[model samples]
Target: MRRLLEGVVPGELLLHYLSLLARGRLSVEEAPGLLDGAGNIDALIREGMAYCHGDDHSMLVAASPDLVLQRALARMAGHLAAEHQRLLDGQERLRAIQAPTDATAGGAMDQLVQILTDGGKIAELTLTLAGSAQRDWLILGARMAADASDATSTSANCRALYESRCVASAGERESVEAVIRAGGMVRLAPRVGMSMRLADEAIALLPLSERNPSGALLIQSSVIVGALREYFELLWERATPYGVPDVEEGPLPPIQMKILRLLVQGLSDTVVAERVGVSVTTVGRHVTAIREALGVQHRFALGVVAVQQGLVE
Candidate 1:
């Protein structure tokens, strides 16, 4: 729900379609396309809601795509042929209802027919990503495009959190902070070697390389997601919370504040001195004072504490 609403659609949608297909009630082709707009997303969402309520029929019947969409679905037959028989069985079951059609039957029957005829293009896209060796690149491009187009991607009812290690390049740092400023609760991890990101329930695992050229795997299975959520909570427990204060508490002297800010940027002591127009000895003194004042043992920890306490921008 987090990833889908937050615009991590390709992975989440693929996971959703796979789960639905696994149910044996529908095939991949029977699923509506991802780029089918809010109409299909809404349909799938309704199906999910119905599933939650144990009313399988509502989902099976409410999302019948029209004839043209069905025709498009037929072209997906090559990949979806395996499920044809099971779907036919379901249709036959529907047909066996000799009783008078209830108010819901008409709508549900149409949806079932639609599902039989539907195949989502977005699902196909994610499938390609899933099998590709270079999926992360494609997924990243898709996410960037979605980010550009979506103005209201986040859900108001949900809490948003991010853990950044600040090892990202300067430009990437700005972007991360922009996301944090936009309703995200940011934290600083002590260190990280993995290339990963989580959007709601979806977890994107990229190659460990700095550039992450190989691709990414977006997993949304319940077991994996739930476990990952627990792991995230554990990591969060050890992370330093980042809440950029409107006003720096205790108001360190202007020079000390400058030093902390540069240090968080991963600046060296010499560079910090150059930037602040202070001598190396003076910069070291301030660094030591900042650490002691924050009750942290080292400058690295001081930087983390500074960001957490909003002592540094």
Candidate 2:
């Protein structure tokens, strides 16, 4: 089912139909032709892009694609939440099973911690943990020259916090941008003292030393994992979203602010214009103004700076 819809409908077509629907430009009469032109009405319906009505199912309607997409995303988030709870439950079960043995062996603390000194083994385990993440994957203090493949291999819901000074190079920026393109969320912190990875809210991988990547401590203790999770969240709230501005800018107009927020969310200029009741050219103008105001040379940088400046929450 997922594979069938992977590339069946172009995003532009969906957004166009939805924009028309929102503006009352798409009547029942117009929906048929547009849906037909889309060439995948069934897939559209499944994705909440189109609706069928009437006794003979002759009536057709276009739905707000954004609303439908948001609902779908909410469902995915609910599933991730449930999976996280299940992992916690399984940890409880394991603790119950190991109670007697742990008492005899001093404690389960020793069992929960594993040290790896080999570089190859550490790298392999990093990928393994990242690839197997089903819920949240939190990365803190990512290196400047970190491999993009590590970030790309994780689930779509990954969040990374990197030191601001580390990603100064264009190559590092590209690597971080690749992560964003792959659906990973990134934030920049002025300083990130420790490098850590938390997977599925169940396990954590911490480098044994800041200067070395060849040694790590893999921990499955809930106490430690929960503490790390809280720490990550604290840093996440304080850190700026990955794009920092080179210059301070004045506040934007309300309409431009609205458009900027939408743009930062990966919406197209066409969609932003439609949503804001402006022309596409107007959106482009506003984008250009925003880029100049933020001292950025590109759209991606514009988004990052908007986020960093609190223009887009």
How does each model score on TM-score?
Answer: 0.30, 0.45
Q: What is the C-alpha local distance difference test score of candidate 1?
A: 0.44
- TM-score of structure candidate 1: 0.30
Off by over 4 Å in 2: 1-110, 144-147, 244-313
Clashing pairs in 1: 29-118, 33-120, 61-108, 136-215, 136-216
User: What lDDT does the true structure give each of the candidates?
Assistant: 0.44, 0.68
- 63-143 per-residue lDDT for model 2 (tens digits): 654565565677678889999999999988887886656332234434687776766656666776778788777788864
Best by lDDT: 2
**TM-score of candidate 2 relative to the true fold:** 0.45
